[model samples]
Target: MRVTIVMAALAVLATAAFAQDSPSADNGKVVFDKWCTPCHGAVAPPEMPFGGDGLPGTSALGVKYRGELPAVLEERTDLAPEFIETVVRGGLFGMPITRKTEVSESELEDVIAYLTRNNN
Candidate 1:
């Protein structure tokens, strides 16, 4: 009886750990829309005299990957949470690093969940 109780407790702890790591994609979508949509969105208005100033990130990614990968990060099938966190924190190329004050850890987790929802 004692062994069974201990096993159940361990299982519950493990489940909680997993739950904390997954986060909520819905919340993540909100974060992405607020913080990332300006550059990474699929559509943008053509306000510039030369061309549209929207989807810059998408355009850059398209040129960088040469059509081999999707320009949208959210559409990609290969994105790890750790990779997302690192990029957001450290920045890449023209992208600026996000400060913890600008984006809390919890918000970052939500963004990761939204961007990587298609991975699974």
Candidate 2:
């Protein structure tokens, strides 16, 4: 009986440890710095607004969206997660493909968590 109880306690501890751990904003930040910052910069726009006028480069959607991402995403949550996943995987219009080939499915989930932040 004592051995069984000890095993049950170990199982409970293991479950708690695993449940408390999850990939979140910090992991998303690393992915963003590598994949996004070159295009979008650190903060979203209206705060740091700029178009290609200053720099002879990309069309900087940060400035284009102008803080509208939260609203748009909130309004359009009816679209399935797969749709967003496909868009992220393929890239859109002139944007380059966002994900490195090595990124796993779970990392994509982390990115989604970052995008649909609690602000909305």
Candidate 3:
């Protein structure tokens, strides 16, 4: 029927729209560089003391994980979207909570996309 055909067309259009609106990992990298890179970036040296030099968060995580996980945020593959969301909204250990004004919900979604890009 014509109605069935129209419904299928509409569904296809809706899927296309959703795909376009989905979070972009590329954009997420920009957001992460702006907000998270200062603390979680790989700029810090391995010998850098925690809180004494570059990338305190990286240093702390390095010490905490002790090679079990990646200290650099971008290289991490074990991060879950839900866990990232929770940590971003609620302060985790030394990492402070990220406010919506600072990093919008859309940006947060993008960040999650970027961080989880390597996830299988």
Model 2: per-residue Cα lDDT over 1-120, one tens digit each: 999999999999998887556657567656655665555443333322433432211234324556554223323234355665787788776664655564567776665655555432
Per-prediction TM-score to the true structure, in the order listed: 0.74, 0.53, 0.79
Model 1 CA lDDT for position 67: 82
Candidate 2 colliding pairs? none
Every model: Cα RMSD to truth: 3.6, 5.7, 3.4
lDDT of each: 0.85, 0.54, 0.89
**On residues 48-120, what C-alpha lDDT tens digit does candidate 1 reach at each position?**
5755356778778877897899888878888898998998999988899999998889889889888887885
Model 2 ranges with Cα > 4 A deviation: 1-21, 43-59, 66-84, 98-100
**What are the per-residue Cα lDDT tens digits for candidate 3 across 1-120?**
999999999999999999778998999999999999889898865564434457777888877898899999889988999999999999898788889999999999999999999986
Off by over 4 Å in 1: 1-22, 46-53
Q: How do all the candidates rank in terms of TM-score, highest first? A: 3, 1, 2
Which run of 10 residues does model 2 get worst, by summed lDDT?
53-62
